[model samples]
Target: MITSEKIKIYAHYYGDSDMWARRAKSSEKAILSNDWYLIGSLIQEIELVNKGLASEKFTLNLKKHLIESCDNQETIRQLESLLAMNK
Candidate 1:
């Protein structure tokens, strides 16, 4: 489980379009570091934002990152459901 502070950090870091490339790079680093918990928090934040206002780019980026980093079937299912809900 990820702490709320970490979740906020992940959201603030990744939510900046000006920093997107850097964010993606950092996400790749997190993936390589095997930080699934942080990844999960990112996904959770994305889901929260998606529920309020959909951003196809952010959704797609998050989905791609989730697919790449997450191995848990349940998490993937939740991602799918979230995607479906936003669509």
Candidate 2:
């Protein structure tokens, strides 16, 4: 999917829990529940319905997606910085 479409999907999932979504949006680190797995193995790895662990690989994949779909410049900069370190 294109980044824009993925962003919409992300927003839709987050929008389900209105209050929790607002809080998650405001927080730097948020563990959200959604069946939005970009990495297939994550499905097997996670015991919870939609919760994913913050493994190095998972984190990298997420950041890459956000960098593609996120509009926030600061957030992209932060993600890229972190990505550089991982590489």
Best by TM-score: 1
Whole-model lDDT, candidate 2? 0.39
The TM-score between candidate 1 and the true structure equals: 0.37
Write one digit per residue (lDDT tens) for candidate 2, span 5-25.
333434444423454445545
Q: Candidate 1, residue 36: CA error in Å?
A: 6.2
Q: What is the C-alpha RMSD of each candidate to the true structure, in Å?
A: 10.0, 11.4
lDDT of 1 by residue, 1-87 (tens): 333333344344443434533555665445333343455466565766657665777777776766665555565554444333323
* Best by the lDDT measure: 1
For each candidate in turn, the TM-score is: 0.37, 0.28
Query: How far off is residue 74 in model 1, in Å?
Result: 3.5
lDDT of 1: 0.50
Q: Name the runs in model 1 displaced over 4 angstroms.
A: 1-40, 78-87
- Cα deviation of 53, candidate 1, in Å: 2.5
Q: Number of clashing pairs, model 1?
A: 0
